[model samples]
Target: MLKQYKESSQQTYAYGLVDHLNWLDANRLTVASVRADHLRLYMNALTGQGAGVYGVAWRERPPLSNSAAANVATVVKAFYLTSNQADPSVVAWFSRDSSIPQHRRRAVTQNPLSPRRGSARPRFLPDEIVTALFEPGVLTSARDVMVVTWLVDSGIRVGGLCGLRFPDLHLVRDHPCGQRKDPHVHIVGRDDNPNRARAKAYHSWRTSPDGYVNDGVIRAVSEAMIGSFYAYLLDEYHPNQHLVDHEQVLIHTKGHSAGAALTTGGVRKMLRRASQRADLNSYITPHAFRHRAAANLYAASDFNADLVAQEFGWSRAEQVTELYGRSANRHTMKYLTEAWDSIPGRPTGRD
Candidate 1:
């Protein structure tokens, strides 16, 4: 079962199944003897008195959320299916229409415990806020500014940023790095990164096949962003001591962990500190830049959904770009109306 799953996904499934296995052990219920009622009892226990968040141990904490419960149920169902696949004799016991009374049809068919997902607006950082981040003294060090710049320019996830390596960067305008015409950075997924930042995908891509590089997705970044990176490398980074020779892109500027790769938590902390220094009064997350960039691209491209989707690396099935189109069109309509109103004697009164 784990062999067919991605490393990250396998880790998630393994973690979720621990609770189910523990409950099974406590009740003396083997894979061959488990029934729907037993699973329901486990679900009840999950949300009963206390349960921590997803990926957390089943200890005395708050009750499991609807989404969390649904996730656990999904993992448990997958476990049973995998077990049955490993041994055919257990198939009848876990079948949807088996004679086992109290068998859960919902578990096999769908997750009834899952809440209906509602459409929610994507959060974005305002243009002013992003601009303020680059102003002198807004961030404590040049590295923070560079981090925020990469987030805005490339719109990569925090995990991708954390996993960035010096070799992955091709900032030169026309370097012989790969076939790509523009400057870009490669985002590679690795489970062994020191910072614990893993890319969402396993396959690696390159803009140009200049040479064999780390396996990961390639994303084009703005020249300004690349310049900011060099500025950090020259000023704050090289002058500081400790791990003078490192391959990671972003590093801890100060403290005992100086020169180490910045973890996801470190990135969030830097954002909070930068926001406070800039007097923004609101903590801007790295993901917010993704939404902002997507919406901005839609408006700039005259509400072209395909272009926005391609730029953001969203799959065709993920039609969430349509929502961004709607928002973009509203702004365009306002501009069109203003332009019409400016015409002399145009629609001065209702006809």
Candidate 2:
């Protein structure tokens, strides 16, 4: 589970599961023969062991998020299914009907934080905020401005942007990366090891290619941004090489030297610094730009979630529609004006 999720969070979960499995075996059920209902009971035992979150049925443990719980479920279920030491007695307890009935489970009041913790989605940036972020010297680094621009325009996640390669970009309209009448870029969801994952699909169960999502004005913007990043990489580090030996695009800047792909923590730090420079506050983050960009297109393009989702390489359009697509603000105002213009004015109505 830790290796698969790759979130620093799963470590605690791995630890908890290991500890509890030993406890479970001491009482009755062996680890391999654990069933869903038995698992629920085991979860309750953890509550007795101070796993519950501040006097509730939930665990107060650090990594006990709803998503983490879900991941734990997946991990444990996989563990039981794979272990081959279960006899019929073990299998009986592990039967499909082993889910704990509602009556037998922990009966307690729910805390909003306990289950179904939401995804970390930042709000969409307002136009004023973006314009503010780019004020002269607000971003001392030339690279910072470009990062926000690309993030907003391209709707690419911070991780995905950091993982991009130099060869993947095609900036000019006539270049191979360009889409006939549009600006385009080729990007993929590469794993920890970027070299071998080239041309592979991101989620193995899904069919979408890793090198998907190219062609749009955002594509051109991304290409331009990547080009700028390349310039920095060359000027600051390898001035003679055409191919960047490093796999990641955005590298850390240590005083005067070039570093590795701007890490997630570093990205946050950059935003914080920029925010301090501008001396204005609310919230500013990478995903904010992505959200705003999605809103921009959604507001302008007849509420097109499908198009936005595909271009952004989202597995579903629900988030785009529910979160991004709306009928108000600057974009809606312009749309409304155009709609009014299309209809003849000076109408007579019964007063």
Candidate 3:
């Protein structure tokens, strides 16, 4: 798991596996002893359907959500598959014949308890709430403002945003790094970052011979984003001379951790606090801005999925279509209304 997945993902799997292990111990069941039926019972216990040996423990906590339970099932299945590989005697509860003849003879089957995934959809913040967030006194910190602006404008993931470095930003029309005609920022992935924040799409970036990143998921920045960044640099960022030099773009502005790189967790907490201060009814997460950006870009481009995918660094246009294609904007709504009204022999309520 550590070799195949990121540290964060591996940690999630480890935590889930621990719970499974504890449940197995309580039930006196080993990997070889557990069967598909037993695993289904485990899933039931997780979702508060059945409490096998730890009824008291189960009652203390709320049932896991369907998605979370599904994730646990996935982790358990993966664990068993890996265990089976390490020792052939271990029961492979999720193994089945491969559908493709040329592929491996055995394949891992999906957990019966895992929920079927629904079609992807945009989960964006409304324009009014966004306006309220930016209103005076709502978000006072220049750094906070910059962070929100970049998220909304660039649709960069929280991890990528926090992982940014000074060298990744080219805030001029003509930067020495590349031939881009506008200001942009690069999302680079590095495993050794002290904050453990990394770009989700790490494969999209590479350093050039001159120590400049000319190939990466480059996102154009809005003038407002640049202005807020400059404000943060001038008013908030004052790195201590004694600390070791690091080029992380976003750093703590106050407290003992001042000048340290901000983590993705910090960014999330900031957004939550800001949302509360703004009196927002719904909690606004960093990813909500990405959804808004994708929807807005899709609408602005006359519903062009390809353009939205390209702008947001999506690997496939199908991703944009599945996620943002059906997101209705004012323009789309108006067009549909007009088309409906223009249909021949259509009933008019007034008539």
Top candidate when judged by lDDT against the true structure: 3
Better of 2 and 3 by lDDT: 3
Q: For candidate 3, lDDT tens digit of each residue in 307-327? A: 787777788998877777656
Once model 1 is optimally superposed onto the true structure by TM-score, how far is the C-alpha of residue 254 displaced, in angstroms? 1.1
Find the 10 residues in a row with the least total lDDT in model 3: 84-93
What TM-score would every model get versus the actual structure?
0.70, 0.58, 0.83
Model 1: number of clashes? 6
Residue lDDT tens for model 2, 1-351: 356554433554586567556656566656655544556655444434335312123334544445445545555554554467644444444443446576754553222112344654445566777778889988766567667767767766676566566555555567543343444556655555332222222533212245434432233355656565566655543642333447565665554334545665577688888888878675477767667777777766677788777766667898676656642244567787677667877454537
**Per-residue C-alpha lDDT of model 1 across residues 1-351, encoded as one tens digit per residue:** 556777767766676688678766766767777765556556766776333222334456566755577667767766777774333433443453454345665444454333344454665567899889888888867888788888897778898888888778877656566446677777777788877788776665543455535335667889779788889999878866457455677788888888887898999988988888889878898888877777777878777777777655566614645455544444667789889889997776776
Residue 224 error for model 3, in Å? 1.0
lDDT against the true structure, each candidate? 0.70, 0.56, 0.76
Model 2 lDDT at residue 257: 31
Off by over 4 Å in 2: 1-114, 117-122, 177-181, 192-244, 326-351
- Runs with alpha carbons beyond 4 Å of true place in candidate 3: 6-8, 22-30, 41-71, 84-92, 97-113, 239-244, 328-331, 339-351
Predicted structure 3: lDDT = 0.76
The order of the candidates by TM-score, greatest first, is 3, 1, 2
